[model samples]
Target: MSEPAMSEVVANLNLVRERIAEAAVRSGRAPDAVRLVLVTKTVEPSRILEAVRAGQADLGENKVQEGGRKADALAGEPVRWSMIGHLQSNKVKDVLRFADEVQSLDRRSLATALDKRLQSVGRGLDVLVQVNTSGEASKFGLTPEDVPAFLKDLAAFETLRPKGFMTLATFTPDETEVRRCFRLLRDIRDRARQDAPQGDTLTDLSMGMSGDYQWAIEEGATVVRVGQAVFGPRPLPDSHYWPGAAGTA
Candidate 1:
């Protein structure tokens, strides 16, 4: 499987957490405010269990089938699975079965599908409305201007609890552009919160990946989706992480 040893995973996790703490303090916020959702897109269940036992309980997978399989394999483990990929309507039931949160609630069709299924089950799911803050054709999310109204629309879905926003910054090495994208999502969140309903719903900013997470934390990201640094590198390209880029992938 080529994954790291359990001890290596623990050391990697500690390094990541230490960096997170440093970033949070540098940004004038407590490290506890930021939660890390370790991305395990292709990571094996046994390796994932190693991390869970090491005290990193929240895990994120970029595909429904993969996450469901891991959830089955890691059954009875103290892990919380988050559906962090572009979820189609047909996969709603499976995701609801395996995921504790949906981080890519970017479109109304998906929301309608989720709301319908959750209503049938009489259950609720915490969701983060995704924003394509980078304006890339290869990402899935509402536009910056469209997010406030979308957050307002979420109120209609009684079973879908809107917790905050998630986004993919531009896949570039340009620090300025990358940080700009993070800053924009923060601005959108702030503006959305001016409305009482959205204000109550918007509390988290789930932006940044392994490379850009520190900048995201500096700009008020409450949840950072990290993978490569904690689990070694993956074969996928940075663009592959965007839900909208799956067709070409």
Candidate 2:
């Protein structure tokens, strides 16, 4: 497929931002409270730089290695980077170099690995727990039943801060069902905050994507991960990052 004209892409971004603001208002939350994390998966760095120049503060990259490469390329750029897909334990160290926040801390093992890496670097990692609200067989996340133990175990890692929660909306595309899942993540966030240790911080609810972010915002998503809406559909990468020869979305 041919690349979209930059002007068209920029116009689409404005429309998405307007929709996000509208959702925030409808949810009785301040529009300023929500942050947009443009997903730059298969998008080239130049297009990402354009979004940054246009006032986008955060960028999400699915692969740690690719994200690191982009971070190195834009070393002086002022965009905050976020890791918003399944994180491999092996890539923990690589991710540490560029990710200001990781929003897919779904398993206890990954959290432990992250803590060890952060401790080695003498810096804490900001993170959000991913919940399997949709119960999808292909998804990776902690089930609701396991949240308590996960949170309790997470407290031991002072090098990682629990910022919020994240999840992929189901593929069925039911708006109400998607909102329900987002709401569940919000509730989990609240529960975690209430049960957290005295010094623990839980402030964000990241449970949206390009398709249903407005529903997420209406249901209380402080952060939204959008790909196609902002950069247009990503082109397939030259190589894949995982076993299926496919990269995370």
Candidate 3:
């Protein structure tokens, strides 16, 4: 597929930003309260560079290898890489090579692996715990009931900082259901904060995407991972990346 023209990409980005601003205002939050992480899963490097030139520095990727490649290629740029997809323990090292943050941390084992890897580099990483608020069997995240214990366990990993929580809402046209998922995530974040360690700063709620980011912001999202709205639609089907996303797109 041909790459989108830079002008077109910029225009789309402005539109998305406008929506974000509107959402923030509606929620009585400052426009800067939410951060936009452009998801570049299957997008070409050249197009991503265009976005960088256009002033989008935060980029998100679903796969470690793919994100690693982009990070290497754009090494000198002022971009910050974020891992916003389910991560495997074996890929922790690769992810650390470029990712400034990981927004999909779920289980204790993954945290253990990440902490070990960070220890090797003498560095630390910001992470958001992924929660399966929608209750989708195919989704990878800690169940709502399991998040408190997971958050407590994460305190042991000094190298991994808990930044808050991340979640994927149910993929459906029904606005009520989608908002419910976002609300649940926000509630989880609120509850987790009570028992979180004094040093563990849980502040970010990474929710929403191309389809429902505005609703997410309204429901208290501090970070929104957007793709199609800014970069144009991916050539592949959404189901290829997310099981129930095809119909929503």
Candidate 4:
């Protein structure tokens, strides 16, 4: 498939932003309160540039290596980079090099690694603790009971700012379950704000993805990660980028 024209991408982004605004308003929250994070995993840099030009000030990449490459390519662009997927402890330093915020600080080791890396850089990082609210065996995150203590330990790291929480609801086409998990994250965010260490903000819930983002917004997702909904279903990895996976274009 040919890359979308810059104008077309901008139109699509505006439509998605409007949808987020509508969802936020329906939930009795201000539209500005909800931030749309364009999930750039597997997406070409051209689409990423389109999103940046369209006023998507925040972009999320799922892998550290991929994000690092993209960040280098898009250096000097007006965008905030977020690590929105599972981050390995050993990769923390590389990930923090371009990550303005990390939305997947789940394990204690990862947080500690990030803390050390950020301290070395002499910069503070905004982080959202990933919670496995869906109870999926494949997911990595702090359980509900582990959150408070995790927050306490994280607060000891001067360079790590515990801004909020993030979760990936089970990938079923079930809005009810999605909403339940989103609501749970919101409740946890509230509790974190109330119980967090002396100076933490505990705001910014980075929940939901393309499929269930409406439910996430209704349940108070300050940031939503969207990919196909904006760029269309991704081109297959091993295929040439054109119609019918060939040179028909």
Candidate 5:
């Protein structure tokens, strides 16, 4: 596939920002309340740099290796990297090298690994717990019912700061179903805030993506991981990463 022209990239980014502002206003929130994390899973580094030069600063990737490479290539550029996919314990060190934040933190073991590695370097990293609100088998996140206990356990990891929660809503055309997933995540965050010791600091809700970010922002998403909306559609199918996305897309 041909790379998107810089103009096209800039245009798409502006449009996504407009939509984000509109959604924030509709929800009675400030436009700056929502942060856009551009997902560059399969996008080339050169094209991603085009986006960086165009004013995008936060870039998210699903795989540790791929994101590490991009971070290395753009070492001097002012961009923040986020790991937005399920992470394996073995890759924590590599991920820490570039990932400013990990949005897919779902279990205690992963947290343990991250904390150990961050302690080795005497550094701290931000993280958002991933919740599988849709209850999808293929999705990787803590069950909504398990989040409170998870958050309580997370308080032990001093180096892994709990920034907020992240989730992937159901891939569906039904607005009601999609909204239900987002609402579940928000409700979970609210309840956790009241119950968990560290919940007060869990302010960021990393939800939404290219297809449903507007609805996500309306439901209280503080950070939206958008890809195709700003970079154009990926050459590979969405189902390769998200099951059930083919029909929805």
Candidate 6:
């Protein structure tokens, strides 16, 4: 696939931003309240830089090595990097080098790895606990039932700040199924707040993708990972971007 034109990236960004605004307004929330994190997996560094120069503040990359390369290429640019795919303990070092946040923090072991790495550098990281709202075996996240206890356990990792929850709604055309998955994440967040060390900190919901961001906004998503709508469809197979074939934004 051709790299997205600079003009195309800018134009698509405008359209996506407008859609986000309309979605937020329909949900009775200010447009700025919802944050857009452009998922840039498989996009080359130059084109990714194009989007960054076009005013995209947050960018999500699925792989640590790829993110690190982009981070190196775009060093000094004003962009926040996020690891939005399944994280491994071994990759924590590379991930910490670039990611401002880890949106797929699902396991205690991974949390421990991240905390240890951050402590070495004397920096703290913002993270969202990933929840398998769709109940799919292929997805990587804490089960909804396990989330409350998990949030409580996060207090042990001082370098890790719990920002909220992230989830990938079921990849289907049915809006009901998609919205249900999103609402479940919100509901779980609501219930887990009482068990959290700081309830106010769990203020963001990282749900939604290119296909169903509006539904996610209506269901209370403060963070949306968008890709195809902004960068155009990725040319590779699902496994190419998301190992194990997890759905992309």
RMSD list, candidates in order: 3.7, 4.2, 3.5, 6.3, 3.5, 3.3
lDDT by residue (186-240, candidate 4, tens digit) is: 8888888888793348888888777778788888888888876787766654122
lDDT of each: 0.85, 0.80, 0.86, 0.79, 0.86, 0.89
Q: Write the per-residue lDDT of candidate 3 for residues 33-124, one digit (tens) a residue.
A: 89999999888888888788888989998889989998988889999999987788999989999999999898888999999989999999
Candidate 5 global TM-score: 0.94
Candidate 2: clashing pairs of residues: none
Worst 10 residues of 2 by lDDT: 238-247
Higher-TM-score candidate of 2 and 5: 5
Q: How well is each residue in 161-234 modelled by candidate 2, as lDDT tens digits?
A: 88777887665566777777888888877787778662246778887777788888888889988877877655
Candidate 3 residue spans exceeding 4 A from truth: 1-6, 198-200, 242-249
Kindly report which residue stretches of model 1 are placed more than 4 angstroms away from their true locations once superposed.
1-6, 238-249
Top lDDT prediction, candidate number: 6
TM accuracy, model 3: 0.93
TM-score of each: 0.93, 0.90, 0.93, 0.89, 0.94, 0.95
State the TM-score for model 6. 0.95
Clashes by residue pair, model 4: 1-242
Which candidate has the top score in TM-score? 6
- What is the alpha-carbon RMSD of candidate 3 to the true structure? 3.5
lDDT of 6 by residue, 1-249 (tens): 899555788889889999999999999999888999998888888888777888898999998998999899889999999999888899999999899999999999999999998999999999999999999888788999898788878989999999899999888999999999999999988877776785878888999999899999999999999998988988986577776535658
Off by over 4 Å in 5: 1-6, 239-249
Candidate order by decreasing lDDT:
6, 5, 3, 1, 2, 4
Candidate 3: worst-modelled 10 consecutive residues by lDDT: 240-249
* lDDT of candidate 5 over 74-189, digit per residue (tens): 99999999988778999998999899999989899999999999999999999999998888877788998898888879888889888889988888878899889999989988
